[model samples]
Target: MKRTIPPLLTAAALAAGCGTVSTSASSGGGEDAVTVESCGRDVTVDGVPERVVSMHPSLTELLVQLGVGDRVVAQAQDALGEPSPELAAEVDAITSISADVPPTREDLLAQSPDFVISGTEYEFSAEQGFAGYEDLEKAGAPAYVATAGCIDRRSEGAVADTFTDLENLGRIFGVEDRASELVTQAEQDLAEIEEIIGDDDPVRAVQVYVEGGKLYAIGGAVEIDVLRLGGGENLFAGDSRFDDFFAAEVNPEVVVDLQPDAFVFAVNDAAHEEQTRAYLEQTLADTPAVRNGLLVAVDNTYVQPGTLSAITGARIVAEALHG
Candidate 1:
């Protein structure tokens, strides 16, 4: 499978970054101390985390790819989605929690997860349902949130961030080698995409989400950077044009005039796809995307960002635009 890690990044380099830093318990090939840094906080792992409760689907996919699917005692339901045949049984075996929200405090505590991985969008916020970092520690589990889900940060783009997550997970699960392999695959995938788009003028695209009968475009490039990196240009890069901050529901007529080459929609599920279909065939009837029929749906979970999702999402967007 094609992956998204940078080509020059060696396995030794990756393993070194995430491997146990201390040799106190290195009698064999064992890790003595492992730590993962997230949102500027360091989360230490004494040994491999056996009971990991993934609060998000992207994280669940990471576990499956890391070859530690059995370590996942339970995961946020639908986090893995309808698995792609190869992983059907593996995903089916794990218990599902809430699909759209954080599992309740009682529900989460019941699982007794040594590590809790959540998307920063909402689940990371304590008041939303699942407790905060402090709460996770109190419950005997270290809190880990995906950096991709973070707001207002560009220190790491999707590709780099995904690798970071994989490395961190590897550190915790003793799977640095597997993580490295995935990274190599990711690098090749990225190289292929870069070659496809190779110095060509970027294809202008307007990505939006349909909610409550309103059309809302993504405000930040953070989540959609993979698309941009894959050569899809954002029509809303400027603040004065689209106001990515407030993300005001723009008049569909406003978008029709942009005449984007492609229409990217946040179609997380079938319902979202159905919704965007209308936007394509009706609301933007006059645009190039509609006329050319260049409509694409991005899984919301995939948008959340992870090594696998980043690579897969990049490929999905690249195919839709230039396939």
Candidate 2:
């Protein structure tokens, strides 16, 4: 799936300042020039990007939410979930550069994007043959890494941290007003969730994922914060083993030993949900969660960091735990 770097973005092209970047920001009143710290790097966008490449579904959804869906010329093809009704048309309009896989460097360079955004630093891995920041920079595109995706910043991630992405994108696209309104709405929603879970002891839960006959427990990630927002606490929060890993394999014996009140798990579809529940029921039959039928299933995308649906996820978790 790897392709050689396109000749169009070679040293010669870079020397001549050749690329598809627009020279002006949007007509709306926003800073013509904006700089933000993105994944330990200071990235500056010369003007609002008119042609953007979004490397993750969550970030693409965020762009559509910011009212800039028309500017997205290309997007990653791996969809964790279906687009919301509000975003369906826009999501359908953008061309997908890869299918359920990371887009390659040449694939990205061919688009001549004015800007590029990804949910994680992994999208820009040079070793994996994906376009790196320097590659995008050579094409006159500024790369933006979501704050929630930054490894160093995620240890204490909160659902509110989504605000930073919204605000930063607002400034980048001259849609500050739209961003502000969304933030206000999200805050109000979170407040309501808090009110619902008030004065209740937190639910001790473990967020589990089963893949390829292996079991993993989510730890040291924003998923933990989402769990906390819903009045639940992850048993593996701050576990040194997951300080850098999002989720890791665990012995089934550990789940039996911990005796959590509930199991918050992710599922891809209805059939998968049924299968996961049956597996958990059999594997951990004696655990309180299985015995009490306290397993809560969440959509794959909702639990991802910095997603707007994460608010909905927190509410779902709260309802499952408190009610």
Candidate 3:
């Protein structure tokens, strides 16, 4: 793939200085360290971390993409969505230190990790009994949160945020080349999907998450930005109800009134996808999306904040919307 940044992503980088991530080499305490902007904070990692704890599968997958999977000493093995086939074996091999998704402070500290990375800052929530950033810092472990999951960046996140995280990880792990390669591949993949969708009238869709018959619309997050790359416009992207939130419970009547052109839903597996499709078909049979068979199912992981999987999600959306 051609190593290039997408033109649209330039704006993503310039949106806010808080979301921007950069790295600089520093000699602190007679040790080589890399200081990078993460979650609107400056975190310096002294030397490459040989023992790292990944708080979520997304972060774990990203570390693997950066060619530092071997450094991951412990990870949370949650079945949030399907794991990437290419890296499933390697990811599964990583030890799970706790049954909890975000291991407690005690368990995490016991591992004596030098570095800890999480998809969301919530993983470091002291209120939730998990290891906070301060706790990690005091324990000689620097914690880094992905830009997409930053409290200030989550609502306005985009595909470029993932690139920022990738580059930052590369710098931290002394694998800048590998990170660039992955970013280039993602950019090329998105470009190809966009080219295929060129000149097509964008579909008006709503990304919905269903569980126990409750409906939640995904909006004001990176998924909305990713959907646009696939030639779809979210009906609720500008709604105040979804402002600054990933998903919000929406009334079925509201969806029926909008009569969306398509329904882009997230699924954990094929069965989940089929169940969502069936529910849409039966509950909102009058909607154009249901009648026209324009329901698109994307893996849940692909729809999360700033993930390389968004490329795959956008492709799935592009093919369904334009093909």
Q: Would you estimate the TM-scores of all the predictions?
A: 0.82, 0.86, 0.87
Which residue segments of model 2 deviate by more than 4 Å? 1-31
Clashing pairs in 1: 3-185, 3-186, 4-186, 5-186, 5-187, 57-79
Per-residue lDDT tens digits for candidate 3, residues 24-69, read 2122432678888887677888889999998766667788878889
Candidate 3 is scored at a TM of 0.87
Please give the lDDT score for candidate 3.
0.75
Q: What is the overall TM-score of model 1 with all chains considered together?
A: 0.82
Q: For model 2, what is the alpha-carbon lDDT of residue 54?
A: 88
Q: Regarding lDDT, does 1 or 2 come out ahead?
A: 2
Candidate 1 regions off by >4 Å?
Answer: 1-31, 77-85, 152-157, 240-248
lDDT of 2 by residue, 147-230 (tens): 877645555556677899898899989999999999999999999999889899998899887655667787855677788888
Better of 1 and 2 by TM-score: 2
Rank by lDDT, descending? 3, 2, 1
